[model samples]
Target chain A: MALDDPRATPPPDDPAAREADAARLIGDERLPCGRLVSHAWEQARAAGDQPDPHMDGCAFCRQAVEGLTALDSTTRTLWAERPSARTVADRVMRAVRAEVRLGRMLPLDDPTRELRIAETAAAKVLRRAADRVPGVRAASCRLTPAEGSTRVTIAMTLAVTLDRPLPGRAAEVRRAVAHAAEQELGLAVSTIDLRIASVLEPLKPTASDEPTLRDGSGR
Target chain B: MTAVRTASVERTAARAALAVPGVSELQPSLRQSLAEAATRVRRTLGSAAPSPETGIHAERAPRTGAWHVEVRCVLDEDRRALDTARDVRESVGSAVDAYATRHGIPGPVTVVVTVTRTTGHRPSHHPGTTAP
Candidate 1:
């Protein structure tokens, strides 16, 4: 066996550099997506194989595997709970509609007739527009309609894979949402209240339908 | 100015929105359903429950007397949802306008359409009939 070389340079420790390396690795198909990595973890665990070198050395893959393992453990603990009746999309839409219904309407200044835009509808427009941004999901929205203007309050959830600057992302989300609402609905948004509810880590592998080793081992 | 009842406006708008082809159904959001379910459970346990709203939401504009209509409907998967949404918008808008004109209401009505879901029970590219 060859002796381990002490002069070899280790992998980069900076978060950006590591992410750049990960992107390159993904492009090269050496380090696959997090879902594949999680699946590989499961397979390796079941096969009693050694941990792959990429995961052992790469921070990105290691975090993903850990997150998956933690999620699996958490899911197992809640296995007996009743499943949700509605899909996530349905739940989001419902919350938005209910919130809208409760909002006070703002008046319009049309010369032909008395006009108004419901605060709820304006909120929905903003939420949908904000959700279109990458890495951002609008969890909730509140619109306070004023004289010829509206103030938007948005509670957004974020999905982040690597260490990206969150302030920049938040600004981008705000601008995009504001622009979309103004252009699409023709409403003036005076203020935007953004609340970052939670940050979602990278996507993990879905639980496989295949029987686990635990189930088949005894049989 | 003729007195405009919100109920009448909602009814007219809902009728117009439903008239659009490929509209599957007006659906409440899942969150609302759960809240209703929880309220039902609470009522069974001796608590008050609030009624849930359906898909269409209509109200007067803020600061102005103009009416605003909001609708959320599911569409058939075969048809283009965007085009169907546009059709629904125009239909709702015209229906509101007609109601205002007939009733002699002084305020204008604006309709907002939101296509909430699409049913994929049947594929668009089947061999038999072309999707309308």
Candidate 2:
């Protein structure tokens, strides 16, 4: 926030106030001219939008003034903008989410490029795919990017009816999940590691007994 | 060397990418959205029109003066995702190339496409192709 804080005061006339403002805005580093750019900026600022005596003769001071004035103008312009509260909140939330990073980002295709899909998003797609298999319900789906590669490895837990062979059902679920990742989302699935987490009561066909398709992007 | 407006390149690339089939809409990454927000809060840094660059980011490299453009999208699952992504890359690259030539900007353009989500994949039945 110092980027948009107002500069409404007519440069403070008191010497102490001027020094305080300079201390707030400028850092300790000196310029190439062996003078603090902050001091040059302060001198110009205290003059009330005009150059002080030092700036009239010093090249370093003049150069500093030029930059400081442009920066001030930019600051004022930014402060002048009155964007909607919703817009500001959206930006803040996006930044916060990005910082927290809910899950690792998995690359979609090219590893060299900046093309990636959030792990959570890809998992959702795979989960839905696994759940579509007859008598199978995906308990958990986790996708991990292979070491130094764009391919992805899937580790999923499935709950399925014990009517069919456990290993066969697991294989079917793996195929469905892998197909969804590669065909639906264009993710190169390296290997699928599946675990039979639980046994669900056999489904008594009530309405739709057949496996149904769920869109990868619907959820 | 002529200076090229980064936004102009982004807009052109976005339009070209969207024109390709299977691209449902542009989806900006969290990082891209945050960067755009920061720039807007600070100052309008001569970016292009509002809508087109929503999911596109274009920047010029300082050393070689080359252009790197990235496009993010949510695609239709019915269409082949990899094929569509490849098409998007080519489409964006060609459009940016033409834009550079027209503007007399000298630099190689690199376009990268990412498919973040896909929907409507073979929706519930009628599996494959059949005689019409």
Candidate 3:
């Protein structure tokens, strides 16, 4: 600005005055290029679609104008559409939900190798394995890394039908779980400890019933 | 230059991992993505979710020249997660190794695969068949 301009700052000889002007400048809107967007906006408004030489010469000023133009377009758009608050909330919530994740991880084969899986995710798979046994419904399945090794110990609570002996059912579940761990997931099963939580009325005559399972017909 | 190579390798790794069976989807490392979002001055201006180039991080050790890669993914619930992740690790490793070999970047590429979550679908397991 020219020294005479009323909007110009007082001489820099007075540090306090310069600091105050600097503070005011910061409160104003600026483009990514560090130029005041409002000045370029005013020039654009005055030119009435004609490109001005000052803004054309300045990269920062041109950037400011483009940003202001986007803002103006957005303003007109928002005003014209007046979208519902629900729409805005849905959009925001979708983004928030997308980012809401990450949990305890379990190592795959070798801890040194860095292959891992989400702890809960792995647990769910293991639990489902136990649940696959006829008349066995696994309620709780927990996995913890055995100290100093990549192998994991599984502790599960099962509810099985009274038709079969508890030991027999438990053995079946252990086999199923162990097979799943080693074959399907490539997880090392250290030990599968089971707690018979509750006995339930046997599930209605599925072909792979307890008798079939007991006969070793169930795979 | 390091960033460019890392990005290139990460992209290749992501593509390879996605193609592997049982890899339902890929996700950014929560910590890395959070740090990026936090450091930026504008939060609302961020990209939407499930965007490409977020999940895989590949970096070359300055001294050893060994490239360390981390992959985060969501596995298909019906498929085995461990085997899937192992496959992912191998797939990513092989793809990255090829990229390194082509670029003539030094050092072996080692990949660590992480399962972030699994897809919700769990098909009913057949009674006579061993559960997957």
Best by TM-score: 3
Candidate 3, residue A29: how far the Cα is off, in Å: 9.5
Query: CA lDDT, every prediction?
Result: 0.53, 0.70, 0.68
lDDT of 3 by residue, A1-219 (tens): 111222333454665444433323334677665556656655655564565787667777765555545544433344344445665555555545555533356677765747887767777777888877877777787888866778888889877678767777777788888877775566887888999876766545564444223334342
RMSD of 1: 27.4
Please tell me what DockQ candidate 1 reaches.
Answer: 0.02
Order of models, best DockQ first: 3, 2, 1
Q: Distance (Å) between predicted and true CA of B83, model 2?
A: 1.2
lDDT of 1: 0.53
Q: What is the TM-score of chain A, computed separately for every candidate? A: 0.40, 0.50, 0.53
Candidate 1 Cα misplacement greater than 4 A, ranges = A1-102, A106-125, A148-162, A203-219, B1-132
- Regions more than 4 Å wrong, model 2: A1-91, A94-103, A109-115, A205-219, B1-4, B31-49, B124-132
DockQ of each: 0.02, 0.20, 0.30
- Name the better of 1 and 3 by DockQ: 3
Candidate 1 falls in which docking quality class? incorrect
Order of the predicted models by lDDT, top scorer first: 2, 3, 1
Tens digits of per-residue lDDT for model 1, A111-154: 32123345555555566655555455576776665543334344
